[model samples]
Target: MKKTILSILIGLLVVCFAGIVSADGIETGIYYEVDVSFDDDVEPGDSFDVEVEVTNIYNQNGTYVDIEDINVEVVIKDIDDSGSDDLDDDDDIDDLEYNVDDSIDFEFEIPLAVDDQSYDIYVTVEGDDENNGTRYTETFNFTVNVEKKRHKLMMKEPVVNYETLKCSRTTEVSVTLWNIGTSDEDVEMTVYNTELDISEKSSFDLDAGDDEDDIKTRRSFVLDLADAAAKTYTFYVKAEYDDGDERETEPFTLKVEDCPTEEPEEEEVTIVEEPTTPVITTPAVVEEETFMDQYGAALLLGLAYLVVIIVGVVLVIRLKKR
Candidate 1:
């Protein structure tokens, strides 16, 4: 009877200890998961580096758990723009390893294609954790956003010899072309003005992105103003790049003015003497009277008439006597 009682006490004690062990053997929780990032803006056909780090929280209860056989991978999937559909797998990274509480940093290069967009980067880490001397598997997932690449072309302001030109002189107008896309481009630049009889075409190759020290080809169009009028003239500039990418600047204007005249030279001054005044003379005035001269001529005429009457009487008597 005493042996049976001792066996029962031993069984009860074993059951109590088993319950305690089960309570103390829970899985260790993850402390933190993060990715090292340098650039948030990514362009197409670009290769860049990405990093990842994971840490485990310290267990406070009974048994300590350590992880092994850690395999880390990076997967880029093309998720829809609305982010509702299942992601289509596009790329995968190779396997890696890590331990519990170990700071795992993974650095690798990822090359993006020209058509890759609306995607997500998923970093998955799998490892075996020790739970009360028993190993269990665990997985962790992390995500990041990859933006779409931009393909663009731009035009710079044109250079000209004169904003206000002269109609009798030649003017040189030059235009510089730049490539702002993600790859090299074949560019064709043209400057034309039919009114001025100016048409010049030139072609060149440009590199991707902006550089302060980059060499650029400047195309020049010579405008002969021999027959041009004095007015505002508009010149058109066109730039054509890769895959039918074309851009044109606003109408550049040049004002033609009349040519300036030369100034006359100054001459020496000399002093001269003034001329003398000339003398003047006046004529005398006359009076009108003739009554005396008329009376004298009348008396003589009366005397001659008396003599002729006497001669006439004598001649008459002589004739009677005959």
Candidate 2:
């Protein structure tokens, strides 16, 4: 009976020790659960958000235990030929009570050089028990799908010959379109300014390739500002491809000024007058007296006196003879 009682006591002691060891060796008192949310269709060279909902259910010794110094982090693994990136750690969560939950957002940007493939995303949650200072960590992972559009058209910045234009003048505007998609595309380019009532469009085919010359096409247009006002005008360049998809460039500005005033021209006048006839006049004639006309009158008076004297002499001669 003594040996049986000793064996029974040894068995009881072994069971109690095992129980104590099992209770002390509990891996964690904090439970972690996560819910992830993201976009279904992801693309390269795009910025997106990944929302994570974290819940903590703390239970220790049949009692609720609070956790403190909580931190959350996120990392995106590299895909084929793509690079990896890490989000900043969110350590502002000081403590979490039993059955409490919180949400975090991780903003991510895919590299422009990434390929069309799936990538892995990792989320880690770490904290410590407030009572015993035991560290607890949990990690969760998910996948993100990345794909590129089959037909994508992009417009480069427009090359304008003049930023400021004069009224009744013209400007040359040129732009280039790029086929950055996976296949060849037929592109339609348009440059327009609704306020100025100016619109121009052209169509061309572009071969899809990585080379700059292979995938790009250029077009030029001359814009007449004959009826434009003297205020600011905005121009836009748009590209349409693959039957419905389109892209537009940033707004370009062109300022118009009023044309200068022109001075009036003076008229020339010619004066003409008929020719005048000259007058002619004749002078009167007066003859001057000669010397013989004056002497003829004196000679006639003397000859009359001489004839009377001769007659007296003849009478005297006749008286003497008687």
Candidate 3:
């Protein structure tokens, strides 16, 4: 029994030694690449995403190999102007598992809340490659650059010189803008109406300052009300800066009234009688035409008068002979 136990112990030691040799050989064949990228135009007090692509390559016995399973973790360090090595307050990402062949991607979000200045982010990626339960830990370090942030552009309520406008007329709309940040801003103002035509104010430079009066810059937009109707018109104003900063103001409204109408002129009139009345002749008999034609016609009266005159003359002659 003692001899058998000794032989089993020797066999176990040999198997352990073989695994150690295989791990050593595979470590030399393992290779990886780290690529880091983030937004370069990120502003202060804003959040942005950073992407890291980790690619692992392995070859054993002169043939390409694939890692059956792996786990990845990341640590972020925000380096100030003065470099420091301590990472007590740094951000740490938990472990994630994946089956990797050639490459894998990891994404993280970074929120910046500091002054408008340049900064650097250091990232450390820790991962393990497991092939048949043999684990190899791989680590890579990379740096990302963050540029200076620009200030915000602010706009006040717009003003209109005229309270009301008439059709086929033009007016001006005034607006003031301020650079409320740390740097100067090149601003352009655009003014538009839903029912009227207006021109924009462009290319105005403004400097930042603590006092509101010093930093304020005003511009005027010409609004033409030609062919506009009689109603209220709202003008929307938007201010854009050189660094893609934008601000919009509340709608400014103006009234349009119809012009007064003029009275028409009156001309002299003349009345003249017609030379002859218009007669309507028909084929019906005169007696059936009207009541006056049946009783008071001129032709019938002339015959009755002739008969009376002849009777009177005969009676006078007969009286003279008797």
* Candidate 1 deviant stretches above 4 angstroms: 1-151, 209-217, 243-245, 261-322
Model 3 scores a C-alpha lDDT of 0.55
Q: What is the C-alpha lDDT of each candidate?
A: 0.53, 0.70, 0.55
Cα-based TM-score, every candidate: 0.36, 0.51, 0.35
Error of 3 at 96 (Å): 65
Better of 1 and 3 by lDDT: 3
Q: After superposition, which runs of candidate 2 have C-alpha atoms over 4 Å from their true positions?
A: 1-30, 45-47, 60-63, 79-91, 110-113, 154-180, 184-229, 243-251, 259-322
Better candidate by lDDT, 1 or 2: 2
Clashing pairs in 3: none
Tell me how far the alpha carbon of residue 78 in candidate 2 is from the true structure, in angstroms, after superposition: 2.4
TM-score of 3: 0.35
Query: Over the stretch 275-309, how does candidate 2's per-residue lDDT look in tens digits?
Result: 88977767878787787687887777788788888
Give lDDT: candidate 2, residue 46. 70
Local error of candidate 2 at residue 156 (angstroms): 7.4
Best by lDDT: 2
